[model samples]
Target: MAIIFEEKQNIFHLQANDTSYVMQIIRDGYLSHLYWGRKINQYNHSNKLQFVDRAFSGNPYPSIDRTFSLDTLPQEYPGYGNTDYRNPAYQLQLDNGTTVTDLRYKSHVIYKGKPALEGLPAVYAEDKNEAETLEITLEDQIADISVLLTYTVYEQRNVITRTAKIINTGSASVDLKRALSVNIDFRDADFDFLHLPGAWGRERHIERQPLRSGIQSVESRRGASSHQHNPFVALLRKGTNEDNGEVFGLNLVYSGNFLAQAEVDQFNNTRVSLGINPFDFNWKLNPGESFQCPEAVMVYSHEGLGGMSRTFHDLYRTRLCRGTFRDKERPILINNWEATYFDFNADKIEQIAKAGKELGIELFVLDDGWFGKRDDDTSSLGDWFVDKGKLPSGLEDLVNRVRNMDMEFGLWFEPEMISVNSDLYRKHPDWCLHVPNRTRSESRNQLVLDFSRKDVCDEMIKMVSDILASCPITYVKWDMNRHMTEIGSAILPPDQQRETAHRYMLGLYRVMDEITAAFPHVLFESCSGGGGRFDPGILYYMPQTWTSDNTDAISRLKIQYGTSLVYPISSMGSHVSDIPNHQVHRYTSLDIRGDAAMSGNLGYELDLSKLTEKEKEVVKKQVSTYKEIRKLIQFGDFYRLISPFENNEAAWAFINKDKDEAIVFYFRLLSEANSPFESFKVKGLDPLKSYKVENTNDIYGGDELEFVGLSVPTELNGDFQSHVWRLKALK
Candidate 1:
């Protein structure tokens, strides 16, 4: 059984494939964390961690028994008023202006299937037996609040998902200060802190440091998951790398401001927490109301960091992302963003569409200039109407023309943004989020819509859905170009002003849920400038996102590499752009650009008609090659053969489900005259089988590929050089 409750010992044993997690109810109804890591069946509940009394610390229930203390125990859900100083998972502020909460385990129930979070996005079990869940309810009797800690174990994916739901049943309203999704306690600080942090251009770079005394945390306060800190953190043993050592990964399925923290206690024990950032957050839970926190996934890998990453990959790709395109091949698309920018008309778009059709492109996306008078970034954002000046016949006519050219059509919409000069803004200025009389900051000449209001969100859904229904558009690029500023909503009270950003996200999810349900066949891709909103929360609605605006091949090697640490390659929207590459202006060969872009959802973001005949031929070959290997790239098990963060050469490989075929992609940034040749070895293959290289019919045993290594040509000493090798195993 994936979930086993040892009733005799009052212990809960949760197993997810190769991992096991155990917790038990101790003296005075205090729930304590026992063991997590590896698959073990035995857990001596009586032999718990020693609880020592300490000064200025929370004493365990029944003050007479001075031996047990909450401050020294490894509690699963410690509260603030309990006197436990090591960061409480939640805090309650009563209506009388008192901040105190003491919660104890009330009851728990084991179930066969997972339960859905009321108003949140979570990983669901497609089948009844694929996962099991345990719901432990804790109550603060004095505060009249109940917290449900949910744990879901996937039987075959080595994944454990957790969520928290807080119910307010008191007479007066209560304010929830902190309600973290997951809080875990480790026995000792024998690990390192691993996080992904960077700025606007360079995002999600890998960083590892020693576990210090104070708290180490990663957070985003920009009303987004932000380009700064991704909502993921891992604890790794010293010297742990991709191939070896124990690692524990925790990821929050949320896209707003989030916090992931770790603190080493006085006794060297580590307590890590992840969920909504409580800095500028306060949710008002009135009587008979409940607040559901976002889901956080936990994965343990004894094999190494690679195993940890692969576990996240499998669960997110197959279980979290939904819709028709979840398991299907994404169409090869060409966007006119870099080609014309804001200077293109319907005729220019039609010209590009015709050219792309000739080059065998599957889709043509009209990026930003077709709607309103959006010739520049300054005006007409909320007006979703198509400008007849750009396309005299309107949007449906262009969609029909693109369909006539034997290609699917896609349109872009920034529904969450409003322009001061637009018709919608002129009519309903208060609809945008802002503080009264406070100067609202704008990025790219736009303000964020107050999605906290249902009327505004509903209007957006109607406008976009009507356009999609009337046109033959099969894809929608939903975008939010700026972050929220002066985030006070006009409709919310001053006391609830801090809840605007989170409410906006909830409204956005509701809008997406309705529209995607209405147009089930359409593929939706989310974007924020580019990769700003690329997080698991948004991935629930859209299967893919634009990875970045920096299409430079050299820069992409790192951006895409870092994104793949938690996100799957399929979710990244990458494309080959024209050189003197737009963002960095670094020139590279056409094949090199395609090789880098093909690592993601294959696409082109340049004008096909203006390309030289040779470049067009190169594109034709690139599209064909992607179609040939996309099955393996999209659904295969990926292994990082070389780390871009650690090595100069970026290399990775993928193998099919049955392991009969494999392909390796390698890139060389620059070559030196005297550097020695380096050979790369492959992993996760049948060693006894004989494999044949596709380009050359030479055969070798799989053992040679793993042990003796695959020969890479070291003589191609040039800038931006790359290679792609394919192998098939003979049965």
Candidate 2:
């Protein structure tokens, strides 16, 4: 690993191997160094900022010098750079507000902060395999003011990445309320903010406010008071009703024992501020105590919120790129929960395997109700033994039977939870995360396992690994059915209670890291009650995630459209369930449902044995079509030609990487009141290039498609209908 510091360009590049993984880093126009492969704390208090001038001019500041001064600085100057700035050992202040001292200073101008701070540039490298990390530190003290910033940069692949841990090591915490604003060119008429619930499943919105100055704060708390305290705030600036582009700003304020706050200003000026808030805020940090806040990420792009989302996603992908599909075969899987529920034996699984083989399914997954005394959701959890009543021959025999049918066996495990009625909870009630003697709540008849405890995490990893090693299971569907309650950890020390959530997540990553290392070929899918845990963080370990429980074709159009804005289609699990649609209770045409499901990793969630003959035939043909074009749909670049939100009719197109073929799906939600023809002009194609169109029923080409876009004759008087066209570029 090498750290490349282009001093003249104000850019720091860290390269691990030979990849340009971490792209670029801008340090407010100051000399920045590239540190390589070093622990974070080594550079703590090393980087210092000199008070160069007052009356700063730039969006943040004209120069780093203008922002810090020694003489008469705020008495409570909160530390910057690192989150744990309240420690007196790291604090410094100017006597006469003139000069201070550097606690972790290495040189004159170079400052070191966390590796993540350099943004993308500091960690830029050529190849991820050989990439190294660089630790850079800087510090300056004149009079009473002292400032420090440290960063680390490294390369994992052909990508550059950087992470910064900013620490304001000063006697008086300074109000570092700063904003780094970037001007973005959005060429779209409307946009939306995508919100993913942490534990709550309710949908909230920040409507498009078409005016230049207003602040809206929405509070969301699903019965957790501490969670309800701080409301997420959004500020929108719209140019004009007719104007397409609008400037939006979001601010997340951190209060309580920690005094850090960040505000993003993008209306007249673009800037982001990270530091302590100055308004009526005074918190005492005991001698060795510390405070840390969540990271603040900003995105600016010309393609609206969807484009901005892609930027962040692309950044994550570049940093964490583990190839998917260990082998090159479509996973033909059957999840047994819907098939047999809690009633199944070795012979029962054998029967299902025989049926699946006849239907071309390649994997048999045993969902919940397999472990402990678990006949239902209420009983055993944490007890990872086979339920003798259900599977008398044990999991090994069941797995062998499925494998003998030339199919892979898979199993489901909610490792992060435990049923209160289980033996594990009965023996070690303190192991669960709850305030001592407080009421313990249960979701899905289970309590969350305290992953923050090393012993609990170890136990889970050991039991899960043992099961996989003992059986021929090739896949694992890891599910988390509920969000956290009680929010307290028994393992963490009293002072570190706030750190439990982060520690639990870290523990999860550790277990996964070990699992994937041992079983490289086994596939893992992360599910949080469905789509609750669908985020870039979870995607780091799993290739795909269950999209949502709502599989109604009509509702899914919007649900999936919103989902695709952030995730790739390959990562979405779209299953064809029985109509009178299970969740939404809306009946959709079988053809429409199959077509909608085809837009994702096509599969069935309904019981195949219960389907009518006609329905089964529809599924058989649907499966055939999916097998034929799954590759094109899976790996193709997607484009939203017409938004389902803007128009009643939803239209989307998928183009293969070669650009030789494309598929456009247009669904007419309802007929327009008086329009002669309910057709919309489709975009995202080369107008001059002639192409042949193939609908399942008919094929049309060249001149026949020249004037009018693909038309659908009124059916049921044009209430709700759909049309799909496969377009191939004519050679």
Candidate 3:
């Protein structure tokens, strides 16, 4: 069993394969965090919770002991206003208008397997032996509320998932002011705060800072988990690097507004909290009503950030993400967004599809401007019907033409948005999210649809379902171009107006659940103006996401590398787009672009017919080479040898599950004159094996390549140069 409970000491120990998390119900019923790190064979009842009577740290339970104060104790889930002044895991406003809450440990249950969250995305236990769960109930008798804190430990993974369920057990209604998923108190603040933060085109750029004496956080108030900040944060020990030292990471499995923060108190104790953002948010829990927070995943790695990343990749790729495509090799698709954009006819699209087919592309995706009377981003967003002006005959005809070339067909849809000029918006102006009489702000020339309404969600499901059922669509590129603005639902009550954003996410998940389930054969790839909503919640429904809109090879080195910190390679929709790149407008070689793109699900987003014969031949070989290693690239274990953020040269490797075949990609942004000989140690290779490099006479023992180093090709020249080395274990 992964979980063990000691009744005498009131301690709960969650032991994963390589890590352990220990906590206990201490004096006054407060659950104190004992330890979290490398697996401890036996905790030996180590009590790290110390009591210090500081000047202002109030002692809530002075009758038992005057020095016992929550402010100084390491806590699991803490509440504010009652001695502990730190950020709370949850807070409730009672009927009497008091905001203080005192929760005492009631009881706990240990069981096999994990239970799914009521209406949220979470990691699951596929088999009973895969995980164990513990539920600790804490009750606030005065408020008549109970918070059920659940912890699930994956038996073979160094991961622990946490969630909280707040139930209003009294007859009176309770207003939940804040409900965070999980919280942990560290003994010291000596760590570096690592987060993925960036804007639209440049998503998930890793940034790390040393912990100071205040709050360091990454939050999204933009409704969708905006491109500004991902729902993940990590803490690295002082001297930790990519390969060694301790790292603790947390990720929220939610797509809506969320908060992940680390607060270093004046006493130097660090409190980490993650869950739904309490900003502009409130939930009214009536008697017998319960509110469930989204799940927060915790990864403890003594092997540093790389070790932390691999654990998340393994757990999320196999457990958190669901559907048929989760384990399957994604097809090499060619999207026409960059190729034609809002200017394309059926004949033009067919030409591009034919050109791609001749070069070994397996799927052809027709991007925007195919629905409603849409000519540009300004109109007909909610209209899901095909535009006869663009298709001439309808979606079915175009789909048939693509399928005729022995290629799959994919279509793009932005179902959660509406244009003021759209027919649907004309019929129902209140359909878009807005505050009464407030100017409905527009982004990308569109407004976010009020998905909080069942009417809106039903219409979206119907419209999207009709299109999929009408055509032989094999894939879908679901896109949302705008974030929420004036985010008030016309149908919700005034008191519940603050619930608009979260409700919208719930409504979207419901719609996606229904539509994707109905069209089980369709391979769905979620996009929020490209990588805006690329989070675990969306990945639960759609297995993959468009990594970014900026397909520039050099720019993508950082984007892709940072993304690999939490997401699996199979979940990144990377493509070789036209250069001068559409977003950055910086020209890079075709070879480097392909090299950058091949690290994920390979695709192309350019007008293939416009390529020269030489470029076409190069693209054909890129496609063929990608096909030969698609499975290895998508399913293999990923290793980040060198960070693009740290060096001008970036390198990464992928080794198959059998540890026999390996592929390494090295890229340089700019050629350095007389650069010193470059070699870097690789990882995850069997030391006993001798491997031969493909297309060369070079052979070396795996130990030499992994320990001594793998050399960069000295002959390569010019800026944005790249090389791919394929190694095969020799008998």
- Which is the leading candidate under TM-score? 3
Clashing pairs in 3: none
Cα-based lDDT for every prediction: 0.87, 0.52, 0.92
In order, how many clashes per candidate?
0, 111, 0
| C-alpha root-mean-square deviation, each candidate | 1.4, 9.2, 1.0
Q: How far in Å is the alpha carbon of 223 misplaced in model 3?
A: 0.4
lDDT of 2 by residue, 380-443 (tens): 8889888888888789888888888898888888888888999999988877778777889888
lDDT of 1 at 663: 85
TM-scores, one per candidate: 0.98, 0.71, 0.99
> Per-residue lDDT for 1-731 in model 1, tens only?
88888878778899988998999887767788998888886777544677566766656555586666777788787887565778988887998888888777899887777787665778888987999889999888988999989999999977999998899978889998888999998879999999988776677788999999879999988888988889999999988888888899999998899999999998898999999999889999999999999999999998788899889888888888998999999989999989999998788999999989998889999999788899899999999988889889898888888999999999999988999989999999999989999998888999999999999999999988888888888998988888778988999998899899899889988998899889989989998878888888888889999888888887888888888878887898889999898788899999889999998888899989899999999999999999999878877888888877887789888888788898888888887778887888888777898888887978878788888888778666788889988889997
Model 3 RMSD in Å is: 1.0
Candidate 1, residue 426: how far the Cα is off, in Å: 0.4
Q: Pick the candidate with the highest lDDT.
A: 3
Worst 10 residues of 2 by lDDT: 178-187
Ranking by lDDT: 3, 1, 2
**For candidate 1, what is the total of clashing residue pairs?**
0
In candidate 3, position 379 carries an lDDT of 90
Better of 1 and 2 by lDDT: 1
**Which model is ahead, 2 or 3, in terms of lDDT?**
3
